[model samples]
Target: MAFASYPSLRDKVVFVTGGASGIGATFVSEFHAQGSKVAFVDLSEDEGRALSGKLAGSWFRRCDVTDAFALQSAIRDAAEALGPITVLINNVANDTRHDAASVTPEQWRKALAVNLDPAMVASVAVYPMMKQAGGGSIVNVSSINAIWGPGHMPAYVAAKGAINSLSKGLGREWGPDRIRVNALSPGWVITPRQLELWLTPEAEAEWSKLVALKDRLMPEDIARMAMFLAADDSRMITGQNFIVDAGRL
Candidate 1:
C-alpha cells in the first residue's frame, strides 16, 4: 500500500535521538525515504552505524543522552556535517518498570535524565540554527503511559508526563522564532525493547482488548505520525500532543 509523501521534506536536515533502533530507527529510515538528510544519535553504536551505512546520506553518532554535554556535542557535530537542522525528534527514553516504593533519589534523577533532560538540551542546541533558518519543527516523543499512569513505572510515568509539559513550554517559548514544538504520544508500540523485556502474551492480549483498533501498533505507525509532525505540512501546528495509539486513548 502507498502512503502520503511530503514534498517539502526533501533536502531538509533532521536530527533524531535514540534513533539507532526501534521507533527511532524507523524515524531515521522513513525520513531518509522522504529525501531528508537524516542524522541520528544513540548508545547502540553497531545498529546506528549499520543504519547509517545503509542510507546514502544518513549520519549516526553513539552518544548517551543522559550526558548533556555529549548529547549537545553530537547534535552540533550532526549540524556541522548535515546543514542546519530544520527538524528535531527527541525520541530518547527508558521505560524500565520499577517499584515506586523503592525508587531512590538517584534513580529518580536518572529517570528524568533519560526521559526529559535531553529534549531540553537538544532543543536549546538547535534553537539558534532553527531560528537562523527562519523556522523548524520539534517532535518530543511522549507515551500514553503518561496518561494511563500504570503501576510499576512511577519514575517513567513522571518523566514522560514532564515531557508533555516541556513540549508545550518550548512551543510557547519558540513560537516567536517560528520554531514549532509538539509532543507525539504513542501507545503500546511493540518495539524490540518492549517485546524483549515486557509484552508477554497475556500483556499483549490485554492490550488488544483495550484499544478500539484491531491491528497491533508498529514502529512505522508511530514514525509516520512523526513524519507529518516534522514536515512542513505541520508548520502551523504547535504545542499540541498528538496521540497515535490506535484509539487506545
Candidate 2:
C-alpha cells in the first residue's frame, strides 16, 4: 500500500533517534500523520524543540546518541511522557564521508558510536519494556554503502555493515519476545544537505543511471517503508533488510 494509505497507528508510541532533520525528521512527520505519538532525540536543540512543539503530541529531547547516559535518560523520560513505546527507529547516523587513510581512531569510533551503538543501546533499552508491553518493532536505518561501498566513506560503510548485522542478530535473539527487528538501507536520497554537498549535476546524472526508477528516492519514500516496518502490517518480517534504493544495487 502507498504510505499515506498505510494502516492506522493510533495509540502507538514511537521513539526515533536523530530526528531533528533529514530522513529522521521525515519519519517523525510520517508517524505523526499515522496517528502515532512520537518521541525523538537530536543534538539540534532549537530544531528539536520547535518540531516537537509543532507536532503537538510529540516529544523531542536534546541528546547525542553516542552518549549512553543521555540516551537512557531521554528514552526513559520520553516513555514516561508517551507511555510504553511500541516502536523504536534507530535512524541516527554519522554519514560524513571519510576515506580509510584519512580516518583517525577517534573518527572511526565516533562513526560506529553514531551509526551502530545507538541501535544496540535503544533496542536493548526497549527489550524488557516491549516484553512487558507485549511486543514492538525496531527498525535500524542502514545505508546503501553497506551493501555497495562507493569507496569515499570507509568508516560509514563499516558502521552501516555493523548496523545491518546487529539488526539481524537482535532479530534472532528477540524473536521469542515477539519484538521485530529489521533494517532499512536507502540509496541516494536528495536531502538538502546532500543536494548542497554531493549532488552536483554530474553526480545526480550518475546516481540516476544506477537506479531503474526515473525519480530519486525522497525522504518520504524511505519514511513510508519505515512506517510499514513500525506498523503491525509487517508483523511477520524480522531480521531482514529492506532496500529503498530505487534499485541502486
Candidate whose TM-score is highest: 1
RMSD of each: 0.9, 1.3
Clashing residue pairs in candidate 1 are: none
lDDT tens digits by residue: candidate 1, 1-249: 799899999999999999999999999999999999999999999999999999998999999999999989998999999999999999999888899999899999999899989999999999999999999999999999999899998988988898899999999999999999999999989798898888798888888889999698999999999999988888899999999999883
Q: For model 1, what is the C-alpha lDDT against the true structure?
A: 0.93
> Candidate 2, residue 148: CA error in Å?
0.6
Per-residue error (Å), model 2, residue 6: 4.1
**For residues 1-249, what per-residue lDDT tens digits would candidate 2 score against the true structure?**
533555557879899999999999999998998889999999999989988888988999899889998998899999999999879999998788777888888988888888788889998888888989888999999998898877978878988998899999989999999999999999888898898788898988887888899687799999999998988889899999999988863
What are the TM-scores, per candidate, against the unseen true structure?
A: 0.98, 0.97
Error of 2 at 4 (Å): 4.1
